[model samples]
Target: MEFYLFNLIRWILNIYYYILIARILMSWVPGMERTPIGGILYRLTEPYLSPFRRIIPPISFGGMGLDLSPIVAFLAYSFLEGGIFTVLRSLFHWVG
Candidate 1:
């Protein structure tokens, strides 16, 4: 039971992590965002990203813009995953 739960949690995290990476990659390809799949990805990622975007606005350097929200978003997700894994591991350890 615990093994199934752990794998499920990791799978979910991996999916979200890939989605986030895909969102960033999609931006570089012109007109990608206009496609249906791209739009769906945008919609799914935006809610979580918007807050970080607001907090860390794009930094301008020599007329080039760098969006840091994605980096922050990934870091935040790592923290969340770590905490979840820690709790679940302790639970399973106690039970076993």
Candidate 2:
């Protein structure tokens, strides 16, 4: 049971991490958001991305501007997934 839970959580986090990547790619395409999948991706990813955006803001170098929030979000996801995996591994070992 515990192993199943650990795998499930890991799987979910992995999937969401990929979704974030996809959302980043979709943003560069013109008029993608009007389509169904694009809209779904937007809705799914925005909640996770919003806080990072608030903290980082968009940065400008000359005429070009870049959003740093997605990079921060990916870093956060890596941290979260590593912590959860470590805890789950230790707990499983302790219990079993």
lDDT of 2 by residue, 1-96 (tens): 887897789789989989999999998888998899999999999999999999997889787778988998898989988888888889788342
Clashing pairs in 1: none
Score candidate 2 by TM-score against the native. Answer: 0.87
Q: Superposing every Cα of model 2 onto the true structure, what RMSD results? A: 2.2
lDDT digits (tens) for residues 1-96 of candidate 1: 898899898899999899989999998888999999999999989898899999999999789778888898999999999889889989898332
Q: Lowest lDDT 10-mer window, candidate 1?
A: 87-96
Top TM-score: which candidate number?
A: 1
| lDDT (CA) per prediction | 0.90, 0.88
Count of backbone clashes for each model?
Answer: 0, 0
